[model samples]
Target: MTVAATEPRVVAARRRVPRGSARRHIIAAATELFARRGYEATSVQEIVAAAEVTKGALYHWFGSKSELLTSIYRELLAEQTARLRDIAEGPGPVQERLRAAALDVVAHTADHVDELTVWARSAHLLDDEQAEATRRERRAYHDLFRDLVREGQDAGVVRTDVSATVITHMFLSALGNTHTWFRPDGPLTFAEVGEQLVALFVGGLRP
Candidate 1:
């Protein structure tokens, strides 16, 4: 009789975890998995095992595997957007702010190299809706940086010969592809590399 009465409650209890340790563990595990194994190859079973959570926990928190992928990047993008927004609005000369802004982006990307590497490798595998959503988030970041460049131009510090749009793309392109060849033990320290990249950007902006 007791077993029969307990059966219903057991069935009712799903693996619903609140926004707590399990969710964070799953995200970190997934990020590492995707970075190391490639998103397409990583399986939900593997994620569950790595995260040490049940399948129900993953489903309870995230809608699907694609959502996990999007969340990883969206989380990073959100923090980056906040950083760029602060630097852009901070008190300073526009040219100095612009340089600082570009440096901030490169610095953050460098620090989260694995996440960036995951993004570079797995972005193409995302569906159209997922891809477009990520693009919009990225576009917002791009717009903020570009606006800073335009502000510099208006202030007569940045060059007028080149459009702000082109300058924005150029620096980002270099930074985005850094994962392809950059090495830690190379002759240039990462700091030196970042400084040189910023130099290339700021020098190009001179009127």
Candidate 2:
């Protein structure tokens, strides 16, 4: 039997493009502009010009500016969620798995500083429903990481004094805030920064 090929990515009512380049270009342009110019300050016209696509084309892939912004974050969140799920559920010593999960999330955030910065700065502007949806998705990722911590706690590798909930949020808060001060050209490379952050996280979990 022949296997079926995966369907292509389509956004905004499935408008077709020249091999999906239109969607790719719009997302890329919007991410850069939203990161550089505040999302509110970045106009659709500017995005169109930067993307070299028409306003209609932009709208074809995104229903509204908010939708575009959400897409940027949702995609990144989806990618992170996949990685987190793998690390959380994959077989290993609970302590090692917990450490790996913390390191992975921080590293992922550091890698996507620009796009994540755009979302962090502009997510408040999203409409209530969209904002809630994003939060739900983000919360799911948080819960996945927390589950690993809970596993370690149950196994006595992690301290029972701190709630797994608090521990998870504490590490995640730092990981999410890396964009505020981290600089690629700074004395410490992002990898070094992530290492230090992970060390602090794992240290706190010690029994």
Candidate 3:
């Protein structure tokens, strides 16, 4: 007896075939090479070889090396944006929510340090189009944090003297830089470090 192929089965198989996994694999390999060899020294051939994928596949997914780098950075930025949005929209007192938001930012950044490093190094090299896209994506996330801070200030939950933009920028810069000192096997967990950071910035632990 012959078996018939169904649409559902075909779709399921396609989904299970690791849709964007290959792209991520290439990005991971490229990130490692870039970190060790520097962006200019790392070649697409090396990246594909390291990822165990074909040059055609890499090209199909990301048109060029610069595009690949942009895609990877965008992926990391999107993850951060989602985390911040979730925390900002979570149900809690304004101050508590802001603290949670800050902690979430730190945790996500620490968790994806490799991607963060790639972003930090290569982001500035993106061409005008890529740079603009990244800036817009980043600004959307920043605006979310800014709105949250503004709400807190309006409700008298946050200090009224500081501008929301300033507060948001300060929190983002501090959390974004944590990758420099954060260690996966270190004494402090991301959560603990996040809390300490939030307390320092938000609560001002003066008492």
Best candidate, TM-score: 2
- For residue 74, give model 2's deviation from the true position in Å: 0.8
Higher-ranked by TM-score: 1 or 2: 2
Clashing pairs in 2: none
Note the Cα lDDT for every prediction shown: 0.87, 0.87, 0.79
Quote the RMSD, in angstroms, for model 3. Answer: 8.9
RMSD each, Å = 5.2, 11.7, 8.9
What 10-residue stretch in candidate 2 is worst by lDDT?
11-20
Clashes of each: 0, 0, 0
Q: Write model 2 residue lDDT over 50-114, tens digit each, in one string.
A: 88778898898899989999998999999999998988889989999888887887788778778
Q: Write the per-residue lDDT of candidate 1 for residues 3-71, one digit (tens) a residue.
A: 644534355554533557888989889989988888989999999888878988899989899898888
Candidate 2: segments with Cα more than 4 A from true spot: 1-18
Residues 25-84 of candidate 3: C-alpha lDDT, one tens digit per residue: 888798888877878788999998888777888999989998988887788888888888
Which 10-residue span in candidate 1 carries the lowest summed lDDT? 8-17
Question: TM-score per candidate, in order?
Answer: 0.87, 0.88, 0.81
